[model samples]
Target: MMSFNATLRLAACLSGALFVNAACADQLDDIKKAGKIRIAVAMGTPLFSYLDEKLQPIGSDVETAALLAKDLGVQFEMVSVTNAARIPTLQANKADIVVADLSITPEREKVIDFSRPYAALTIIVAAPKGTVVKDYADLNGKKVGLTRATVNDTMTTQLAKGAEIQRYEDDATLITSVVTGQVDAFSSTPSNLGEVMKRAPQKNWERKFDQKDFLLGIALNKEQPRLKAWINTWVEAKLKDGTLGAIYKKYHGRDLPANVVQL
Candidate 1:
C-alpha cells in the first residue's frame, strides 16, 4: 500500500545505511588512507611493554609495533592499555590492532580474531626459594598473586586448587605484591618473575613450575578480515626473515623456539 515516493525514500535510506556499513567495515583501506595505525600496548609488562628510566615506553612489543607501522608505511600510534583492557580497546575500535602480548586462547577467539603467532611465552608460578612449591598441589592454602585476565591468571585459577588467588591490575603491581611479601607466591611470565627477583634478590625468588607455553598473536576485531589477513602474512614474513626472533632475543636473551618460527 506504500506510495511510489514513500517506497523510493525507504529504498534510498537503506542504500545509505548499507554504504555506511561498508565504509566502516573497510578498516584496511581506512588505515592506509589515514597514514596511521593505532596499536594497543600493555605497559607494566616487563620485556613486553614498560617504561624506561626516561619514562618512555620500551619493550619487545613496542618495538614490534613500530616495526609493523614502518613496514606498512604508516605512522605508529600506541594506545596504552592494561592486559584486561586490550580486547575491550580493540572491540571498541579505539585501536587498529592489539600488539600487546596477547595469548591466543579459545575464549578470546570467540570475541576477536588473531593473526598467526609472532611470539611465545611460558606461564609460571614463582615464590621464594624457601616456599617449596614444586607443583600446583603445593599452592594449597597459599596466597597467589596474578595479573587479572591474563593467561597466567587463567592457568593459576584453574589449576591452583584450594589456594587463595589475589588478582592485580597489572604486572608492576603484582611484582610489588611479591616484593612487599603481600603474596606468598605469584603467577606470571618468567621475564616478569625475573623482574621481581631483581627487585628482591634477598628473598631468593625463583620459578616454581611452568604452567603453559602460550603463543602470542596480534588481536583485531573480528569484522576486519582484510586487516587480519594482512597481519598474518606480515607475521609470516617477519618470522621467516628472523626480524621477530631478533627482537625477542634482544630482550629475552634467547632465540625463539624452532617450532615457533617454523610455524
Candidate 2:
C-alpha cells in the first residue's frame, strides 16, 4: 500500500488539477447567482459609452448592456473602462463582459473570445479645412492625433507611414489636440467627431478619408465559452429584430448601415 504521506500528496495534486480546471468554469452560474452582470465600457467615447449631463452612464453600449442584463434576468452593473483596459478588466475578473467598442481582430482573439459582432465601426481621417489633406498619403509628414493603442492608431501608423503620429490617452484629448491645432488633424470615428462638433463646432475640420469598417463585438474571458456562445445567440436575436440598430440610431442619430448590421 502507498504510504500515508504519498497518498496525501497524490490527493493534493489531483485536487489542485481539478481546481485549475474549474477556474472560470462557472461564469454563467456565478453571474446568475450574483443577480448582476458587470460590463466594462468606455466612459469617454460619445455615442458609445459616456456620461450625460446628469453624469449618468448613457450611450449605445450602456443601453445595449442594460438590455442584455434584462434578458438574462439580472441587474446591469456598469464598470467604466478605457480602451486599453477593456480586455484586462475581463481578464482580471472585474467585469463579466466588455462593451467598450472593442473591435474583433485576429491578434485580440488570441487573448479573449468575442461574441458575434453586435455593431460596426467606421474610422475616418479628419483635418482642418484648407489643409489640402485629401487622402492617407496626404497625412505623410503631417502631425496626426489619435487615441493611443486603438485600431485607429494602428491603421494610421500603417497608412501614414511618414506622418508624425501623436498619440493621446482618450477621445477628449484627441479632440482638444485637433481643435487647438496641437496636431494638424485627428483620426477618429465619425460618431465621435460628430459629438465633438456638437460641443466645439469647429467647422474648419472636415473628413479627409474613410479608413475602414470593422466589426465590433463584446469581449469576454476566453475561459467562458458557454457565456460567449450565449451572448452570440443573444446578439443574433437583437440584430434580426432590429433592436441593435434601433439603439445605434438613437445614440448615433443615423440608421446603422445594413451591410454592417449582421453577423
Candidate 3:
C-alpha cells in the first residue's frame, strides 16, 4: 500500500537501473563487433611493459594482453600508459582493458572491478653488499630511492623510519641514482630489480629484506561485469595450463615464484 508519489519514485529508480544495465551491455557488444581489444599497459616498466632492442613493446604485461586478445578472437592493439593513466584510460572509454600491473585494493575496488590475480609481487630493499642494511630497521636515517606514487614508495614511506626518500619518475632513473650513490639503497619489486641485475651484475646489490605481497589483476570498468567474468575465467584457465608461469620466466629469467596468489 504505497502512496502514489512513492510508487512513482520507485518506478523511476527501477527504470534508471535498467537503462544503465542496457548501456553497459551495448558497450560490450560494440567491442565484440569491432573485433579488437585495446589493452592499456604501463610504459617503461621493465619486465612488465617496456620496449626491447627492436623498439617493440615486449614484456610480461604486453605478452599477457596479447594472449587475452587472441583468446577473445580479436586483434590486440596496445595502448601505452603510465602509472596514473591506468584508470583514466578505462574511464574515458579509450581502452577495453588495462593489464598494467594494477593491484587490487579496497580503495580501488570502489571505482573499478578487478579480475582474479594474474601475478603477485614482493617488494624488497636492495643495497650494495657491504652496506649496513641488514633489515628494515637499518634503513632509518639512510637515503632510499623509490619510484614515486608506487606501492613500494608507500610501503617504505610508512615502514622505514627516518629514511630520506628520493622519488624518481621511473625505475631506470632510480636504478641510476642507486648505483651512483645518490641514494643509500633502493626499494623495489623483484621484477624491476631483476632488470637492473641483468644490466649490471657487477653492482653486487643484495636483497636486504622483503617488504609486502601484492596481487596484480586486470582492471576493468566498474559497469562491465560480463568482461570481468570472462577475464577471470581466462586467467584461471591460463594459470592451470602454466601459460602464466612460462610468461613470468620468459621475462624474469626464473620460474614463477611459488608465493603467487592461488586462484
Clashes of each: 0, 0, 0
Q: lDDT per residue, candidate 1, 154-229, as tens digits?
A: 8888888789999999999999999999999999999988898789889999988889899999998775655766
Instruction: For candidate 3, write residues 114-161 as lDDT tens digits.
Output: 888888677889887888787778988899999876788778898886
TM-score of each: 0.90, 0.87, 0.84
Sorting all predicted structures by TM-score, with the top scorer first, yields 1, 2, 3
- lDDT for model 1, please: 0.88
Q: Candidate 1 regions off by >4 Å? A: 1-25
Deviation in Å, model 3, residue 28 alpha carbon: 2.4
**C-alpha positional error of residue 85 in candidate 2 after TM-score superposition, expressed in Å:** 1.1
- RMSD (CA, Å), each prediction: 7.3, 7.6, 5.9
Winner by TM-score: 1
- Global CA lDDT computed for model 3: 0.79
- What CA RMSD would candidate 3 show? 5.9
lDDT of each: 0.88, 0.81, 0.79
Candidate 3: give the clashing pairs. none
| Model 1 residue 67 distance off true place after TM-score fit, in angstroms | 0.6
